[model samples]
Target: MPSSSATATVTTNVFEAGKYTTVLQKVESRTTCCPANTSPPPPVPPPKPLLIVMPCEAGEFPLLVFLHGYLLYNSFYSQLLQHIASHGFIVIAPQLYLVAGQDSSDENKSVTATTNWLSEGLHHLLPPHVKPNLSKLGLAGHSRGGKTAFASALEKAATTLKFSALIGVDPVDGMDKGKQTTPPVLTYVPHSFDLDMAVMVIGSGLGELKKNPLFPPCAPNGVNHKDFFKECKGPASYFVVKDYGHLDMLDDDTEGIRGKSYILSVQEWEVQGADEEIYRRSCGCIYESILGR
Candidate 1:
């Protein structure tokens, strides 16, 4: 029922915001508690609330469960999530944890719980007349969160809701090669992941380079985006923004010293104009390849 011109417009504008007005909402989980008189407390659910962004208009849209980076708050990605939502998708980003060590096993479990809660709790939280199409559901994350996304899709955690697409934005496994973190997802083998879903890996050209002598590169070599893309099988796409860093996709007003530094770097790239074009082209390619625009 769609016309060719409308499809063409979508194909050409993949890098820009779409034609929908979006709304953002933070939903807290409904927790139940037992009487304090009980001898021992029953197991409580993980307190992983969601930050949902979706179209304000009445329409059915695909859903993407986005996970935050290591120790990063879900609110930091407000701009990026809203951009995707404007493109007619509902993005649910969960605060997996307040603090975490090298182990991601618990984070993986939290993701599973959030995905399962979608069917029962999501509709109630969405805007009136707006619906989510679980069949076209996607899972995406940035930095260490990207590693978590891949692990969850590989069934490292028991997930009842199947994900149709997976995205990793400069995912990092550990400090360096052969030094992978606990429950490592990369096998160091070509096309080793058996995700059985469309995959997209977005890398940053500067991620493997050290920002200073004091700290290691945010996304170190051998365990970063390049390694992730190498192991992905067919029905996959890879994009690397040559002028960006691991945290450049975040909101411009992202707080903290690291955020300020990255914001300046982004400004430099924008001033050049050419770097921004390359970034846009890379993102547009991703939409065409994975979303079939």
Candidate 2:
């Protein structure tokens, strides 16, 4: 477990969404020119209530499935997913509700099932000209969803669906033997997972500080990032962003209150200032390096 602080330096290259255009008009125009249009379009995927974001430019884009934090809505991460999609990757973020009685293990299974569904069925819904490369797949999540992402990867390794990379942004611990539990009372036990894929763990230096006092600290004792990073054995790297909170990596409208002030009402949010720049640069750097953009 080689953990280091902010002493390390990263060449900042911010990701600009305008660089790739996946607009509706252009996508429809390209669809007309697809060579494999002889066959009729397949039916839309079953109503599983999933959020899928795709790039406008036509090509065999890579596929990515994102898991959201426990209790947090999947659509909350739309901005982040859309930004990633603009870089030529198909992102699927599924909404999981623990409040509705779903556990971490249940959510983990949902992730795997969703990935399988995408691999086997999503192509039918896409434009004939726009084919997605299922082999080049990745799993990512925030908070507890990050833990679920890691768990899903382990589960996926057993089957035929293989993931090429895994990313966890300020992941929080909330599982016990594949079950879900909240903090202070439910302690998370780490497992020696054998993952054969590139791993990137992003942590925030101040994640636990800005958390609501009423609830337990988000990244208690660094279990969220450091613990997970240390356990990863194959092709793993860790990056810690100073002065950022757990919510900083999420989309602007994550909280139902809307706008940039919601985080402030409950706890101090670090979306502005250097934190935003670091977040964008780190996201771009990892995507480019992993997806070969």
Candidate 3:
């Protein structure tokens, strides 16, 4: 269970690297079954590996299952994952799929499977003396992965583990609300989300703008972060970061030319009862910037 206090001390800049030393590990799934000699043998399934980033110290830390964006590899967020883990948390990022269609139902199911697998297989992969506190588990993603996180939390896919916090970074549901993909989550209604956990929706002011004329905006107007936040209930907060886009949160080393263009910094902390203070501080900072004070 999370701390009941509503406030936490902030001694350092949240944007900088945390105090703990972190380590990264990659775990590949190994098949235990052998194919029988039959007339028609079934094809073997591909391995779904996991990229784990956690503190190297001996202590219990909260766990967060982070999903990668559309057609993006989990390793693309290596720096971001290490940043969170350095703050005394364990981040488990799974390579859900190498390629996916418009439909995201399968991705939702994959997240569920990965979450359930933690209880049985995660301990074996972790470093000695490092413990994961499953009770404080959180679910978060970027872009399409954000939508999958929300869909999975809304019961679109069943899982035994309970997520205590939910976060969406520039999440988009297709081009608009009218053209939502499979297993749609947004209802286009204010405070309509049935999520029982604390929610945070981070938007990008530049995301709705097209980089060029040939393609649509990465995060469109009607089905973007604005829509996701408007439909959240209490214990929720929304932040719109100016001069950034949907892909800005990814690590600088992410593959492709666009990866070198921009970088966005974000800090991960426990989301039990400190959301209100964080929201208040964020609003104050925005106000000060606007007033030039």
Candidate 1 local lDDT, 154-239, one digit each (tens): 99348778888899988999888888888998999999999788999999887788646666778889899999999999888888
The parts of candidate 2 lying over 4 Å away from their true place are 1-14, 23-47, 98-102, 157-159, 175-191, 255-278
Backbone clash total for model 3 is: 0
Q: Name the weakest run of 10 consecutive residues (lDDT summed) in model 3.
A: 1-10
Better by TM-score, candidate 3 or 2: 3
Instruction: Give me the runs in candidate 1 sitting further than 4 Å from their true place.
Output: 1-12, 31-47, 256-289
Model 1 weakest 10-residue run by lDDT: 1-10
Sort order, lDDT high to low:
1, 3, 2
For residues 33-107, could you state the per-residue lDDT of candidate 2 as single tens digits? Answer: 235645443354422446667755578888787787756666666666666766677777766553634346667
lDDT of 3: 0.70
- What's model 3's lDDT at 148? 91
